[model samples]
Target: MARLLYELCGIEDALRFSPFCWRIRYALAHKGLEAETRPWRFTEKEALAFARHDKVPVLVDGDEVVTDSYNIMRYLDHHYPEAPLLGEGMAETRARFFNHYAERTLAPAILRIIMKDLLCAIHPADRAYFRRNREKRLGCTLEAFHAPAQGLDQLNAALEPLRGQLKTSPFLDGQAPAGADYLLFGHFMWARCASNADLLAESDPVHDWHARMLDLHGGLGRNARRIRDVGAV
Candidate 1:
């Protein structure tokens, strides 16, 4: 394949569950592009040295190398220019805002609720490294950082903005999904692949949007490999 995507995974090479990677995966499917996915783990930074970046979701399109989820999305849309991820005019600007919202607001909130669950889902080789680095960043041990009884209240509170938006339309981008929808979907996909806990109420509009995301592009996101308890439906 001329195009390849290196993604974060657990013990099983098929169990790719990186939120950033999921964004790229969804973007690729949205553009009707096919790229072979390569599984990478946290302890394997050396594997990505060729890209000069220490992260997963690295896109290798022949000689072109792109890192970071947002950048990768832009690269795909720029290079392909067929099925656009962000529409013209101010659409790109609006998508960028939602991308920032997902990375800054949504991701941190989801991490708090699933940090411990994520630890259990990583490769065994990555356990010590992940724990040490994350604990230092969080200023507490994983076990000590519980998000308070089910963490649903905190998660729901963080999702209020999305809930409100969903009530107005079927997706973040008025009539149909665009970059903003994929941006936020990545985090929910992360939780679905890494944890067993139900993060949304059945009646929540955000939950409904998630279901629609899962069903997009012939269920590309829905068919991904997840942990046993939270496997993709």
Candidate 2:
């Protein structure tokens, strides 16, 4: 049986916008594996009941079912040892640090920039649930976070370290792209597919790196559907 990957999508099935899901998508490509994409939506909890998980990025590989993007990456590396996601030597250790940085630093910053846009990108069936839960997490209404200039400024500031790193190396792991690169690029993919917010400036190293990333895996990301075209970089 062919492998299957269930990922979060918006109004269009092609608009797969989950940051975590995007990580695994690129990881799968890096490993030279092609899984059928199952476009899942925000209100599709019941659809995932078979996995006993309410989240997307669920992978079905033959008899094995995997939940969580990080775990799925580990699964791919473990099963397909030829193409590695985590780099060799001490690179895995360094990549772990970048992974943590993406989770602890970059994701939240990007969320602030695209929170409102995200809500609109989702299916009408999911709007109420999405707003209620996200608003609860922020302790304020979704509108408060929508296009906040301060939030965009914070996002640019948060990306400074990445810009500095890219200045010295082509990829996050120096010479080659690693798990860390995929992990962070997923967030940018989220912004790209869900919103038209100009999150990157032309001269920014991060922007250049993102362009290179989009070109990888045969333009898997660059060709994705953008639900809205409110702004451009």
Candidate 3:
């Protein structure tokens, strides 16, 4: 078995935090694949490295630079076919759906809140720096995120389906914490901190599902570092 070298850009707060990166970590752990995790920090130089050098959650299998969560999962599936990340059929499809849904739909809400409310609330001197870094990672105009309102409601709504899903399976894909579970871990990373800080809280299937996922995987890694001591999910 080839032990993979995983490079992650660690950010504990805000939307830029690497929940997506965490998904890859969780998948590596779940697959029982031997690997080393190197936690990287934020800096313009670091951001430039990932962007210019193909960005992160960059999985190094020997010399190959494998990036993107779904793409990495696919690579893993192809190579390590034993404990498959995607199960047989319908289950695998569901995991894929959840992964895409989280990236496409759920992520923007938390991002919007972080961008408009949180970032702007920082000192005026720091906001420009913050916006510049965010735009680099997201490849979008900071002005677009000036209104996080649109992203907020949609995030909550997208999360509604998960509440019902969690009621049935401990993991998003079913009995095992498959690829979707890892993806969800990343998606929920930002909001987890907010509830803890008492800035705001979320309700329902979202909370419950988070509980189950956290219980299974320990906790979402993105916000886990901020724990005064430790956090469950």
lDDT of every predicted structure (CA atoms): 0.85, 0.84, 0.60
lDDT of candidate 1 vs native?
0.85
- In model 1, which runs have C-alpha deviations exceeding 4 angstroms? 87-89, 148-150, 229-233
Per-prediction tally of clashes: 0, 0, 1
- Candidate 3, residue 34: Cα displacement in angstroms equals 3.7
- Evaluate candidate 2 by giving its C-alpha RMSD to the native, one decimal: 2.7
> Candidate 1 on 21-121: residue-level lDDT in tens?
99999999988899998999998999999999999899999999999998898888889998788765798878888888888787777887888778888
Clashing pairs for model 3 are 50-55
Candidate 3 lowest-lDDT run of ten: 192-201
The estimated TM-scores of all candidates read 0.93, 0.92, 0.68
User: lDDT score, residue 32, model 2?
Assistant: 86
- Report the Cα lDDT for residue 108, model 2: 74
Top of the candidates by lDDT: 1
Ranking by lDDT: 1, 2, 3
Please estimate how well model 2 matches the true structure, expressed as its whole-model Cα lDDT: 0.84
**lDDT digits (tens) for residues 94-142 of candidate 2:** 7677778887788777888887778878877889998888889878888
